[model samples]
Target: MGESVAGRLFSVLDAFEDGGPAALRLTDIAARTGLPAPTALRLVRELVAWGGLERGADGRYRLGLRLRMLGAAAPCPRGLLDAALPELRALAARTGGHADLAVRTAPSADGILCLVSGDRLPPHATAYGKVLLAVPPAVLPRHTRHTVGSPGVLARQLAGIRTAGLAVCAEEFRLGEVSVAAPVRGPAGTLAALGVTVPTGVPLDRVTAAVRAAAARVRPPEPPPYPSP
Candidate 1:
């Protein structure tokens, strides 16, 4: 079957993804979406009318405010913040390190639901990102010499990470930053990750232990046992 109007419209938006250039001219959109000039123009205009895209003075288009607001309202982003903030705060206080929580994200044509992509780190390079990478990305971008860009090497590391129940990064993401993280599993599997970043020279012994403990404490709030009669 032929593509739907909605599908064509979304192709225009996806042309800006992969953290690519912020703006594109009409021809860029046409080429990216593989649509003819007139068709691309029509779809672009429709999106502009609906506030889903913005056209600047240079006639370049960019994702607009409406799309960002909608992305912010996704269920996983909201739920992860509510569920992990308390544990994050406590973990930071006890360890004297930067503590964070992240969910794997899945971006579909509509918006990002949380799964299938690393949200806060390079899945092949960071502590929390490794265990959360249930589906590895096709391309691995290198950030440092320590980054495991080779697929075979990363595959080997992932095996050990699962067995150990945590992943540790020693200047893998950046030259001086070090981190360790533990996965928070749900009935379905890993739902999120809790990570702590300590100074480069600090021993991983204490922070590693702390992150594992904190990850166990992070959980989504349960629904009420009974509805009102």
Candidate 2:
């Protein structure tokens, strides 16, 4: 049987991946999608018309901003980022650091997906990742020289974080970077985390307080209970 149009379309989009080039030539897209040049051209033009893809000035194709808008509309348990943004902004303002919101997208995935971030930090080496990883040990791929590679040690560290109600990391993801994070709870459980990253020398006590306060301010909506039998 022939591949469905939808399947081919998805394959074309999936050809793009993180760390790959920002744009792909027509032949590159064709080869990546395993579609003949003619078919790929037809679909690429359609996608461009639909705003799912864009043709750059250089004549290469890239995923369009519309896709990002569409992806943001996808379901989240409790509108997590919307509820947390205010607090996140406050945290960044107070600490003058990178503030981020992260959530566990899947139990099997090794790391949390950042929903909103004020600055970039390696997920495995930051306080936000630690808070998200504390409950269930989804060991992350190492990204830095100081990244914790051992699950056993990470688990123990997470235990301490659970007790302290916050997580802190110093230069673990990148040299001279320090971060602190606290959990935002929902009716179901921990729905997301709030994090702030700063210079290594900044006093953590104030940052930790701000993070905790910000996390407390975000109240993820309660999930509707199951109907009683």
Strongest candidate by TM-score = 1
What value does the lDDT take at residue 187 in candidate 1? 74
Residue-wise C-alpha lDDT for candidate 1, range 35-75, written one tens digit per residue? 99999999999999998889999999977767655654667
Candidate 1 all-Cα RMSD? 5.7
Which digits, one per residue and each the tens of the lDDT, describe model 2 over residues 20-136? 354789999998889999999999998999988889899999777566455445567337778888888888999999788876544544445566632323445778877877443
Candidate 2: regions farther than 4 A off: 8-69, 75-78, 118-123, 134-141, 222-229
- How far off is residue 85 in model 2, in Å? 2.1
Against the true structure, what is each candidate's TM-score? 0.70, 0.66
Candidate 2, which ten residues in sequence have the lowest lDDT sum? Answer: 115-124
RMSD of each: 5.7, 5.7
